[model samples]
Target: MIKVPIIKLRQNMIKKLTTFALILLVVSVTALPALGEDDENNFIALDHGYTVDYYKSYGAPAIQASITGDPEFERGETADLKIKIANVGVISGFKRLNANQKRINDSIEETIALKEMGEEEEATTAKDIEATLQSETKYIEVESTGNFQNVEELETGHTAPLSYTIKVDGNIPAGNYELLLPVTYQYQANVRTVTADAINLGITDVDYSREYKTKTEVLKIPLSIKSEPKFEVTNVSGSLIQGESKVVNITYKNTRETMAKDAFARIIVMSPLSTEKSTVRLGDIGPGEEKTASFEIKAAQDATVKKYGINSEIKYLDDDKNTKFSESMKVNLPLEATEEKFSVTGIAILLIIVIALYQIVNVHRKRNHNNENVSGDENEY
Candidate 1:
């Protein structure tokens, strides 16, 4: 037989004792009583069943849900909306414990008893412990008011998408709008009972009874409706030359159903462009009616020979005499360079030069004829 040193033996014994103490501590902590009423109300428990019904007492469901749909919504347009709901109330590690608390307690008790009987090495495996617990919530149901309908039986960590068809008002302002999503659901409230099985082990039973409550939550779904200014630039006629001033005729049309009273066209001048007449009075322009406005505009000599955008807006006085401006729009103006055109002074100078050249040529021809005659007469003599 091998001789064992007293120091080595004592060290081995101490290690075993320490390990046993740790196991006992884990079991004691795991078997602690369910949360009390005050603690449950104050703390948002993520795992393990609680004896106090916090959600039901506060008229809130334990299930957490969210809404998702098209972020861009246009006025007077109908669209489909989706609301995604999930039971996110269950705690992570305690999911299984909450579901099969009694079964887990039984397993823990058996393991502790085995350890006390010198069979600690044969305790339950991690897989066996997990198998004894369940993480799914029971009897889950949800319903939506105002814009949606009912949804039922949602499991933990599982999401359900609810669809709805909604339309935005035509006259609604162009901005972010919020819609109310009143949700109602029935879920298992926290009602637990603990029963002692032995000195260090107990079984916890969580009631599967459900309670109903409605939660009105505001879903901040973004809706963007663009303003329809119902105005357009119809006809543009004019020629623009670098370093020259010209009159431009622009036709404005009121495309809206309502009439544009005391309408005027306003132009914004930028680089390479200047306008003496910026605003033109168009009087009243009815629906589908067009009116022309003449503006005196000048282009810089070094302006680019390309199309330039002219920013312009239409200001009108409504029936209440309130001045409202239509959405600013851009009109393209083309600039081109061309050869100098013929003028009266240029034509007169050309005619004078032609007459002078003709007279000189005629006089030279006469002199040549006379010289020829003189030569003939001398030869004859």
Candidate 2:
């Protein structure tokens, strides 16, 4: 055999090692996940005298929320909103730690560990869910105490609705609003195996304990506030006098984005105040438009001299021509005291009494003159 150079032989050996190393690096990068990324855990349950982290799951609970029914609501309404919470979580992959398998030697023990860890699908399950709904704008309010409600569990491919009461401001504009629903839930992160008997941990028929991970996700719920005609008593003119009928002019303003057709303004009057015609017709009112309605109201003679509150409302035809009534509005009207001055009738009576007194005084003066003349004539005779 021919002798080969030592450096050349070492060079061939080095090339083979470099090629082998390249192949190994490629396989490792493509095969298993990188360490400390999604691999194994260091948590060992010494209380149960067992090594945990039998399997590492590669998925978490993916939750999404949406409004159940009509997402659009009217203004000035306290409505119950049902939000449907669903879990769309799915397990991407799972890896069973081989070190635990070696530690558990018996076939029955390994089977038990496999069965316990096989429930990797539970990683997608959301449990002990606590949901809270919040509104960023002042126009909307989440009225439910403690931020609505909570859910026990939401399994994959299933949904559950949580009801919350929300109040919409009457003055809120007609538009879409973004409501935030923050949800906190616990999900199975990993299934840790208990090599010792499960009875020691107050659990029976189970050889594994669940490791839960808490996650917080803020979900957006889109809701729309419907546009509708809203009426308000903007201005009220004309004062009411005791024991007399007065014409009151009330100005109504449409403060919303919709129009009202064939609107009728009505006022409800209680005791000490009355009106023969309570309702007056207004032809049509548009957005930001104002309409004045006249009403004849009478106050009792014994009515107090103070400001009175008159409750009024507007009944109008909607876009569908359906009759609808607006929210009750209030306007303060002052009941003035009767003027402290004489009227035409009082002056006439005074004139008549003065004329009769003047006539009597003239008659008395004539009689006195005639008596003096008669006495003088007798003295002369």
**TM values, all candidates:** 0.46, 0.70
**What global local distance difference test value does model 1 have?**
0.57
Query: Which residue pairs of candidate 2 clash?
Result: none
| lDDT digits (tens) for residues 174-205 of candidate 1 | 55544444444434333322223333433233
Q: How far is 316's C-alpha from truth in model 1 (Å)?
A: 2.8
Model 2 per-residue lDDT at 168: 93
> Across residues 84-141, which tens digit of lDDT does each residue of candidate 2 receive?
9889998888776754545456786667656766777788989889998999999999
- The worst-scoring run of ten residues by lDDT in candidate 1 lies at 125-134
lDDT (Cα, 0-100) at 144 in candidate 2: 61
Badly placed stretches (over 4 Å) of model 2 are 1-55, 95-117, 144-148, 192-206, 241-244, 299-307, 335-356, 367-381
- Global lDDT of each model? 0.57, 0.83
Candidate 2, position 195, lDDT: 55
Model 1 has a clash total of: 1
